[model samples]
Target: MADYLDFVGDPGRDDVEGWLYPTDAHLMSVVNDLQVDRGFRGDVLEIGAYKGKSAILLGFFPEAGESLTVCDIFDSGAPVSDGNARENTAFYPGLLQTDFEKNYLRFHDRLPRVHVGPSEELGEIVAPGSCRLVHIDGGHTYEVARADMETARRALGPAGIVVVDDWSSAHIPGVAMALWERYLTGELIPLAFTKGKFYATWDPAGLTAGEVADAVATRPGIEASGTVRLGRYAAAGVTMTPGDWQRYNAGLRAVYSKLYADGGASAPQRVGF
Candidate 1:
């Protein structure tokens, strides 16, 4: 059996390459509470998986009979529309499902069920109310983010959590606007915000934002501000301490450095599908 520590330690560092912005420790703790501590049950879903970084973390908590579904465009060429999504996808040297699979398999024995296409098609592929957690990290464009959020709403089961990446980042203002619009209209309630992600929920009887903030406050090395209630829900901003940040970066660098020494390059290229 794969241990939680394995996914939280060197394997995680090697798989993510520091691309997961919320800090691995913070994400791990939240998922741990949701899965192990609270026993939230259902499959996991990620709309945007970049090299299986955060997707790998989502893979760790699925129990028997539950699968993790990852949706990404991969090598299918960028979206047709000319916007931030196209620009961002083009910026990457390459986007390949093979590289994501290789990184993911380094920790787990298998890959999640992959949907290699636009995230807008997610609702058609995945069953409604089947996911325990839905992560939206795909396209940064307003249209894409809005579509992903709607998909998340339809995909989540009772007690399920939805996390959107780059929600408050200045570079991705579209994501922030989309999320805020939903909140203002009472489509979703804010739970918490990390450096690069926003956590929300649609289940009123499920975990509350204040509860999430309280749990974060108890974790070591994380600094969470006092919760601020907004309408029916509450939210708090969280950040990792400087020492924890340094340690996390050091582990990531060590793994990549070793890979470089063995393979003549730090980063792995796409393997043939």
Candidate 2:
């Protein structure tokens, strides 16, 4: 209750522009807390921050000594290869770095170290094995996702965590292909799977993987993330708690209801979509 859930679970944060499934953030908070409880200290890294919804959630932790770094192309004309121009154009239209900074400053006084260019440049931007956790949510294409994963591999410290968003999403098979390659090669070990993210780590003995499942399984907002056989590895299947499901819908309804009651510009198509 003293962590990210209190902040991100607040309905007020919905005003921030971005997509972050509440459970993904919840799982992250629980696992990160466990790591911190076990006396691990390192920086945090995030790739492809849209407008700082997830970034602010990450900002909740990181004491004076610890740091957080965010990377995004953010209207910077970062090149897209393998026919991803269409994807970029459709997904991020008129996204500005200032917009993200504004949203972040709403929650925190100062911003994390921001990298406003190709995520591949993270190799030079962050020192090797300095990050306790890395979230890979940048490009969706195979090449870019692969490059981001490589950067994550290098950036993670001992018992570090890697979270790849949009893994196994149908629209972006390239993201799936990139992460799956790591799973197959036995480099990144699977810890948990969620609707919008894939959680893993380089813990070769499944120690961190089992700990992640055990940590979040009994947490308030997450379902029982029991261990399940995922290929050659044992991991957990993550989902929203029943309370979270109802709260999510109720939150949407409340937002739209207030919007229309105030005569907002957009018409209400569906109350909860």
Q: Could you say which candidate leads in TM-score?
A: 2
Candidate with the greatest lDDT versus the true structure: 2
Off by over 4 Å in 2: 1-4, 10-13, 205-207, 256-273
lDDT of 1 by residue, 118-144 (tens): 887787889999998888887888887
Give per-model CA RMSD: 5.1, 2.9
lDDT of 2 by residue, 1-273 (tens): 354456555554456656676787788888778878887778999998998888988887685688999999888887767466787788778889999999989878999999888887889979998988899999898888988898999999888889999897799898999998988987778888887888898866434666777787668778754678868888788887777778877877676677788676563322221
Among all windows of 10 consecutive residues in model 2, the one with the lowest summed lDDT is 264-273
lDDT of 2: 0.80
Residue pairs with colliding backbones in model 1 are none
- Pairs of colliding residues, candidate 2: none
